[model samples]
Every structure is written in C-alpha cells, then in structure tokens.
Target: MTAAIELHHVTKRFGRRTAVEDLTLTVPIGEVFGLLGHNGAGKSTAIGMMLGQVWPTAGQVRIHGWDVATQRTRALARVGAIFETPAFYEYLSGLRNLEIFSSYTAPVSQRRLAEVLDWVGLTGREHSAVRTYSHGMRARLALAQALLPHPDLLILDEPGEGLDPEGVHELRQMLQRLHRELGLTLLISSHQLGEMEQLCTRIAVLRQGRKVFEGPWDRVQWAEGPIRLEARPFERAVAGLQAVGLVLEAGRDAEGGWVRPAPGITPDQLARWIVEAGFDLLELRRPRQTLEQFYLSLMRPDPQSDSRSDSREVTRRPAAT
Candidate 1:
C-alpha cells in the first residue's frame, strides 16, 4: 500500500548551506508522526519541501503516491497544512475568513463549514471578528480552515504555540477526536516535547539537518532505568548504595538517588541490600522514562559514550528562512 507521506533521500540546500540532508522517511496512514529537532535543524525546510513550497536540491517527496514536486495540486488536494502563523483578515469574522479561504480551494457547503467550526469548538465564536479572538481562538480558526478541504492528512507546525495550558489541552483533545473519527494522518513539528509525547505514535529526531533517530515511540533505547530509591538516613542509604556499586552516579532529582546495578543485580536485590544494611526502604520503583530524557540524550550524547556519535548541540538558528 502507498504510504500517506514519503520522502526518498530528500535533500534541500540554500546557497552554500544544506537545510536538510539525505532524509528518507515514511508516515503510514492513520499515524500521528512527529518531526522533532532544535531550531535550524531543517524541520521547516523539510516541511516546506513536503508542501512543495521549497524545491529540494535532491530526492523526491510524495504525498498519497503523488509526487509533490511535479504534482503539487493533486498531491496537496489531499493535504492541509498550517506552515506558519495562520493569517486571516483581522477585520473579518471567523466564519467570513474561512468562507474566503475555502473559496480558493474547493467549495464547501455551509453545513460542512458549521461542522468544521463545531469540530474545533468554534461554533459560537464563528461570527466573532478575528481581531477580537484570543490566540487560542485564532488557532482553532486556523484548524477549522484546514479542515474545510476535508483533507486526509494535516500538517501542523507548532500548533500549540502561545496556547495556555487549558487551550493546549483542548487542542490535544480535539486532534485526538479527529484522528479517531476521521482516521486523519497528522504530521506535526513542534518544540513541545511533552505535547508530542501525548500526541504522536512515531517520531523522527533531527540534528544539523540529519536524521539521527527514527522509530516508534516505544522503541527508543534506554540504557539505565530511572529507578528511584528512597530510604531513611539518606547519607547511609547513599553510602550503602555506592558501596555495593549499584549507584553508578548521582542523578539530578532531589528526592532519591538513581541506581545502576551490576550485572544480575535487580531492583529487588538492591532493596534487599538496603534493608539488610538496616536502612528503611521507603520506596523502590523505576519511573517511566520521559521523552525529554530520550531527546536530550539523542541531541547531546556524552563524548565518553560510543552509543551515538551523531548527536550535536541543540541550539536555535540565528534566523530561520
């Protein structure tokens, strides 16, 4: 079956600098795929190429089996994107703005327009002038406009930017509902790792325009469990843990020390050792690894480690193109 989106060894260059290098990726249908990287990591360039706004220097990008380079309209007909800050006439009502934008694409019925507004929770505010709308409301309006085409794929670039916690929550819920109800394929690029962790099924991490890691969310490799150990008489607990060679190094969290057990040494064993040493084993459990930890490790790998040599500094671009 044709992938929902595919990039075959794609590369994009601007002047002497390459924005994206030898990128090859595929987003399966019905998947929430995340494109992640620090600023100037070529995320915007890749998205531009995928949307056929920027021509690639080498390789091909396809959407629903249509080549974006040569078949932009046909390919893009099935795709809706918010490539940057969504723009609408500030003087116009939300409904009027959508009506104007929809006219440029395909004619959408008024009923369908109402449905889209309702889907984005903008039903009552449809008649409100965009100048009066909050950032969250504008985002919802942008989403409503994207849905006007009834697209099979939605590409959102930092859709949650500037949203309050509640607004972000609402947007997440709305996207999840759309994915469930319409089987929509989402290609999202964002700095919000926490939100991406909550939304995406698969991810690709980029650095210096190169893809360093790509895989399902559950497949990220972790070296040590973030096992937390809380015990009475903290100094003794720390000493006992180090003496047994279980605590490799102190972790950043304040509440408990992390354990790096020797071979065949398990959490149960460590707890036993702590208890046998006469310290109260208050708590012992491996907390779930967060995406931030994984992302940091991938972006800034230790020089002493041989695991990943491709990791680089995570910094924003001086100026984005």
Candidate 2:
C-alpha cells in the first residue's frame, strides 16, 4: 500500500506569512482524496508546491517516489492538474484546444487528448469553438488539458469553478469512473463541498494553515451532529436507555429528540426499546450533512475569543480577479 502522494512537514511561506505550516499527509493510491479548507487555508499554496508552480520555503512534496522539487519532471509525469482559472483560447474549437495541448504530450501517450475529452463529457462538442462552448464546457476542456498526458494522478483545484449543476455532476461521474475503472488516483478541492461529498472517498480538512481533520467521509469527527435524528416511540425504560450513553436530542421532534450514538451505538438496542414501548420504530437517520453545515461547523469560531489568530483567514476571499 504505497502512498501515491506524500507530504513531509511541508511549509510554504510568503515573506513574513506562512501560507502552509507544518503540513504532512499521504494520499493512498486509488482513492479520491479531497483537500478541504477555507479560502486562505493554504490549499492553493500547497497545491502549487505540489505541482512545482510554487516552491515551498521548507519541507518537501513527493508523488509516488519522486521528490517534487528535486525531481520535478519525473514527479510531474504522473500528475494532471486544473488550477483556478481554466485558461483556453476561445477562438479555437474544443477539439483544437485539446489538439494544442496534445502536441506537448509524447507521441506514445495513450490517445491522451481524445480519451480525456470523452472522459470529461465533451465528446459531441469536441468540434465546437471554445467561444460557443458553455462555462462547463470550458472547464471540461481545461480538465482535458490536464488529462492530456494520461497521468496516473489527477489534482483538480476547485474543479467545479464555472460549471452549472449539471456540469458539476458530470465531472463527479467522470472522476468516479476514472478512479474505479482506469485506476487513476484523484485528488480534488472545491468550494462546492456538497458535490465533493458525493465523489470523494477520503477528505482532509485544513483551517488556519494547519491540518485539522483527515479521514473517510463517515469518520470525520464533528463535535455536533449536522442533522437532527428522530426515532419514533420512546421506550418506557428511558432511564435505562440513557445509561447506555445515547444523549436525548434535547429538542422536540414528532417522535423523540433522543440523539443516537454517532459510531458506537447499536440500532438493535433502540429497536428493541421501541418494541418494548409498544410503537413502531419508523425513521432513524438524520438529514444529510450539507456542505455549508459541515464546513461552517469546522470553521465556527468562539464569538468572544480573540479573532487575531485567524483574522487574516476569516476575511480572505477567493480571488475574483
């Protein structure tokens, strides 16, 4: 189980400010690993270092076994990336845009451009001028450029930048398909967290230039439940149920506000209690966590606490220029 990507105490500083600090992580092969964070959480800085677009002030980034900074060409051979603005020559046709990128590919690169176009859902629109293509189309074209060299690792930064809902969905499907079928390891980040949940297998949360959380989707440790869970028919033995350590949700629900244990409680215990209570156990799941809710919970601040620590991060917005 060699990691496809590894960062060792990586730090990137700009003048007196550190964009990324003491960062370390591994992205295993064949997994859709997501880099989650706020606008100034150093995601782009880290990513730029990973791609050789920006040099780290300290530490190192490695892809497969190649050191990104020292062995730039070898390390990059396995990576495809889509950074912020997906640049393109609008005057050229979609196919031509791809063709231009394709010229940079080695002749032996696996039908590279064509394969990526189909993978990104631009098969029929390949001949359309870049100007005629929709925003989504342009993004996909940019993706095709990244895919041009048929790299084993794909790094997409805010991949859904200009895509409509439908376009975003298409990219999601494409990533899943590539990960499952082609054995491509995909690492992506986006402000569109809701969409990321549908596609990423594991996610790393970064805040204020440090790693806060990293794990499978289900294993993300949030201090509070994102959605309210309700179980109908409270058991008469409420005291006994509480003894098992499931907290009562403390709010009014049509059924009951008793919160279920996040990962440790068994449904059987509640189910049996419902039977004993002489009522049917109907719904047992919470509402799905929205991107907004999950992100806000992690970035949530202590109102009275000094804001000086992350004042820079909280106020920074994505580049609109």
Candidate 3:
C-alpha cells in the first residue's frame, strides 16, 4: 500500500539558514505518527513542505504517491491540516467560515457540513459568530473545517496548544475516534510530550534540522534504565555489588541505591549474587523510562564527545562496570 506521506531527502533553506536538512520520512496509512522537537527544530518547516506551503531547496515530498511539489492539488486532495493557530473571520458564523473554506476546494453538501460539525462537537454552535466562541470552541471549529473535506489523512501542529486539561482530553478522544472510526492517518507535531506519549504509535525526533531518532514507541523502552536495589547490610551490599562489577549511583533515600547493571547482567542475577553474598535481598526492580526521560537524554550533550551522534545507533548506552 502507498504511504500516507513520504519525504525523500527533503531540504529547505532560507537565505543562509538551513531549516530542514536531508529529511527522509514515511508515514504509513492508519498509523499515528509524531514529529517531535524543541522550538526551531525544523518540524514546522518539514510540515510546510509536505503541505506545499514552503518549497524545499532540495529533494521531493509526496502524499500517497502524488508529488506535493508537482501535483499539489491531487497530493493534498485527501489531506486536512490545522497548521499553527487556526484563524477565522470573527464576524462570520462558524458555519459560514466553514462554508467559505470548503468552497475553495469543492463545495460541500449541507449534510456533509452538519456531519463534520457533529464530529467536532460544534453542532449547536455552528450558527454562532466565531468571535463569541472560546478558545476551545474555536479549536473545534478549526477541526470541523479540516474535516469538511472528508480527508483521509490529518496533520495537526500542536493541536493541544492553549487548551486546558479537559480540552486536551477532548481533543485526544476526538482524534482517537477519527483514527478508529474513519481510519484516518494522523501526523501530529507537538511540544506536549506527555500527550504524544499517549497518542503516537511511532515517532521521529528532529534535532537541529536533522532526524536523530525514528521508530516504534516500544523501541525506546529497550534502553537500559536504572535498577533500584534494596538489600540489608547496605554498606556491604553496595560494596559487594561494586566488587561484582555493578555500577551504583546513590539513591535519594538511604534504603536502597540505583544500579546500572553491565551488559549481560540481569536483575535476577543481581538478586542471586546479593543473596549468595549473605545480604538480605529486599527489593530489586528496573524502573521503566518515560518518553520525557528518553527525549531529555537525547538532548543532553554526550559526555565522551562534542559531536552529535545518531540516536538510533546509541540509544542504549553500555553500563560502566
């Protein structure tokens, strides 16, 4: 099956500044893919190129096999996007704004407009002027406008921006329904790492205009995390573990310390080693690394070198013995 979106060696430069560099990405149909990075990380530039709003300096972008640069209309025919903050003519009714926007592509039927309004939970407010709507309500209207095209793929740039916890929750639930019920492919770019952690099936992280990591969410979990160990005779247990080649970092409390076990060492092995060494093994467990931690780790400077390394190649660091 053709991918929902594809970019091959896409590069964008503005004067002397490079916005995106050699970005090659593919978002398969029915997948919720995330584009993550800090501010000025080239996410917006890449998205703009995909939408044909920003021309790339090099390479090509395609949407479901249609070249965005050469066949923009067809490439975007099945794509809907809420890029940056959605704007509307505040003097017009919500329904009126959607009608005008929909006409730009192809006039949508009244029934279709009603269906989209209902889908975004703006059924009753459709007749109200956009200026009267709150931030959340306006967001719903923007979403309704996107859905007006009956798009197969949805691209959202910071959908949760300016939304409160409840509003964000509603947006998440709505996006889930769109993917589940309509089978729409989604490309979301956001700074809400927690939200992305919940929504994205696969993710690509961009650092300074280049992709540093791209893979399934579970792939990030394979990185080695600290193991919490609690054993009686704390001093002896610590010394014995170190003697056995386990690297230990002092814990917050005195009860236990954190261990970064060397490659080929398991928690079970650590427990066995402790027990056999005459320490009473009280606790042993590896804490799961959250997406935020993984992301921060990627952003941290590598202690061994000043150069940047591909995250995929070194996501899992070997434990020092």
Candidate models: Cα lDDT each: 0.81, 0.71, 0.84
Q: Output the number of the TM-score-best candidate.
A: 3
Pairs that clash in candidate 1: none
TM-score of each: 0.76, 0.77, 0.81
Put down candidate 3 lDDT per residue, 1-321, tens digits, no spaces.
999999998999999999898888889999999999899989999999999999999999999999999999999998889966899999999999999988876899999999888888888888999999999998898888888888999999888899999999999989988889999999999999998888888888888898887777765655565777878876788777878686544353453467767667888888989888888988887656667877776777787753234546336742221
Better of 1 and 3 by TM-score: 3
Ranked by TM-score, the better of candidates 2 and 3 is 3
The TM-score measured for candidate 1 stands at 0.76
* lDDT, residue 315, candidate 1: 20
Task: Arrange candidates by TM-score, descending.
Answer: 3, 2, 1
Which segments of model 2 are wrong by more than 4 Å?
Answer: 89-105, 108-112, 121-134, 221-235, 243-255, 259-263, 272-283, 286-288, 303-321
Q: Write the per-residue lDDT of candidate 1 for residues 1-321, one digit (tens) a residue.
A: 888999999989899998998888889999999999999999989999999989999999999999999998899997888745788999999999999988777888999999889888888988889999988889989999988998999999888888899988988898898798999999999999999988988888888888877777754532244567778876778777877787664453565555556655678888888888898887876555567777776777546554233432222111110
Could you give candidate 2's per-residue lDDT for residues 235-274 as a string of tens digits? 4334445665554433455644545443555556565765
Model 3 weakest lDDT span, ten residues long? 312-321
Report clash pairs, candidate 3.
Answer: none
